[model samples]
Target chain A: MAFPPEHEIHRRRFGRNIGVAVTLALFIVLVFALTVVKVTRGDPMQAFDHSVRPELAAEEAE
Target chain B: MSDIRAYEQPGEAGFGDYVQLLKPRVMSLVVFTALVGLLVAPVSVHPVIAFASILFIALGAGASGALNMWWDADIDAVMRRTKSRPVPAGKVAAGEALAVGLALSGIAVVMLGLAANWLAAGLLAFTIFFYAVVYSMWLKRSTPQNIVIGGAAGAFPPMIGWACATGGISVESLLMFALIFMWTPPHFWALALFMKDDYSNAGVPMLTVTHGRKATRTHILVYTILLVPVAVGAAFTSIGGPIYLAASIALNGWFLIGAWRIWRRDEAMAEADGYATEKSVFRFSLSYLFLHFGAFLAEAALRPYGMGGW
Candidate 1:
């Protein structure tokens, strides 16, 4: 079947749709990067945050 | 012909309309403060995670903005300053805002947990709730103290950033939070002084509307007096250094002079000058906050060189 001609509503809203699409794509990339970083860094607490709570026994200090 | 007629409707919203619904200007403040909070922390966060956490924090802040617009659509439509907002201006529906707020809120909170930790996530959730429900729904229309309490919601971002890095709060985060909290009243009251009818017309119970212009001026002076110590005192914290101290003392002195000038003016004098003093002070309040946060960022940036902190 042939595609119907574009309507004004669709034309006006085209940018909105694309913006939302871009936002969702970025969200996905961010989440994937977060996952990779979390895995590679092991325990986030041990990797950072030692100075803030120095009283706690050092698990793995740099 | 009927379908064509239907399709010809004007005032249809663009993507920017939805962005306006999120209150991008306010979100920029949230993003900046949160980034400073993260960067200034003694704990180091991975770049990727820091970016994601700040992103979600900003999303959470935007969610609160959407919810505020949703709840305030009536008042927004009435206020000249807010009449052009997407919902009140008929570019978007209230239900759509509510939906966007809820969806983004849930996603942001949960994702913050995954990216950072539960502490940061919980703080984000609380900040959203404080702004959306506590301030927007409850306090905004009820009391003149609305902005004072509502300011806490805005103040939470830095603490959340600190939490994101350290998984806990500290004196430094608390001081940052306090700085914004104390500054909110005077900053907004100055705007209210010049905005005149925007709050009164909307029945928002802003200090100017509830007490009186004279009383509002006094309140501005009082809050500015209170804000000086917080702003200057932060210079003595771990995140503070010579740059922050110099900036804070100068900025706070200028801010104090602005407040005192506003306090000394009467309505007749203000009217004769068209609230010029109020408007200038309001403008300065923006820079006051940006520079204070910038000082925090500077101190953190200079720390590696042994120049940032004492």
Candidate 2:
């Protein structure tokens, strides 16, 4: 059966949106997992320090 | 009653239209990179603040997407892949998209600064400008290297996330940025190889159209090769671990193979085969980046067990 023009357009639009939404949901899950790992396991502040201030690591060591 | 009849019928805006405004596809990449940055950094933001920071970053990404849609409505009208965007499809006015983009851009930068640090906020602001002005307005139509240079704007989210955590930039975050920067060319070139007609119709000078498909394919393979060292190198950094190294090796190997497959296919064969190699490369590129970033999270998980980063 042929769908109405407006209905077909809406359907196509909805399908595209669902595709984008699923991609986004997957991304959120990935991000959350990363945040949990960092927050729970490592000192995020220290990680930041080492990340941003590498020279500082040497100075501190000295 | 007579005056009411004079008013034009307003088109209704659907939920899907709003989602289009958020540019969910682009937001996904931004969110992933930002999360990695937040996770790999040495600083720890409060959980609530972290969430808020990411939300703002996503909003900023959406704002950039909206502005891009607004400015490119002319070209987007012709391209098959983008012709159905809200503005081009007539679902949303260009003016409205512009307003939403500007408003969200301001809100995201200010809120990110309030939630995290000014450095992160500043980076978000610069990213928006780079995307909206440098890539969308200037480079897109002017050169074939649009994706090459424009990719930098897309690569900044992770660095901003890192900044939010550490309140500054670092070597590790730069390395993460470099990985995405290098990966963007091959990832986009693969799509261009198959979608050559779209760029041609849109009057956009994509590499495939400007330089030919064979050249684009060669460039894709070269970039894919370059991406390998950057991805593998990250595994040796403070954020790297056994899990990340193993995952990077396996994923990058498969990715190189996919690139090789794309490079090996002749135009006639690719057309006869329905561009299967091109399509596979495009699909794999998406998963490849996700898996690489996901590996970082896995490494982070193993850290407590002393199995991560040398």
Best by TM-score: 1
* iRMSD, all candidates: 1.6, 7.2
Native contacts recovered, each model: 0.78, 0.00
In angstroms, the error of model 1 at B236 is 1.5
Worst ten-residue run, lDDT, model 2 chain A? A42-51
| B174-216: candidate 1 lDDT, tens digit per residue | 9999999999999999999988888888878998887999999
Q: Name the weakest run of 10 consecutive residues (lDDT summed) in model 1 chain B.
A: B1-10
Q: What is the TM-score of chain A, computed separately for every candidate?
A: 0.54, 0.55
The per-candidate count of clashes, in order, stands at 0, 11
lDDT of each: 0.92, 0.86
Point out where model 2 deviates above 4 Å.
A1-62, B1-10
B139 Cα displacement, candidate 2 (Å): 0.5
DockQ of each: 0.51, 0.05
User: Which clashing pairs does model 1 show?
Assistant: none
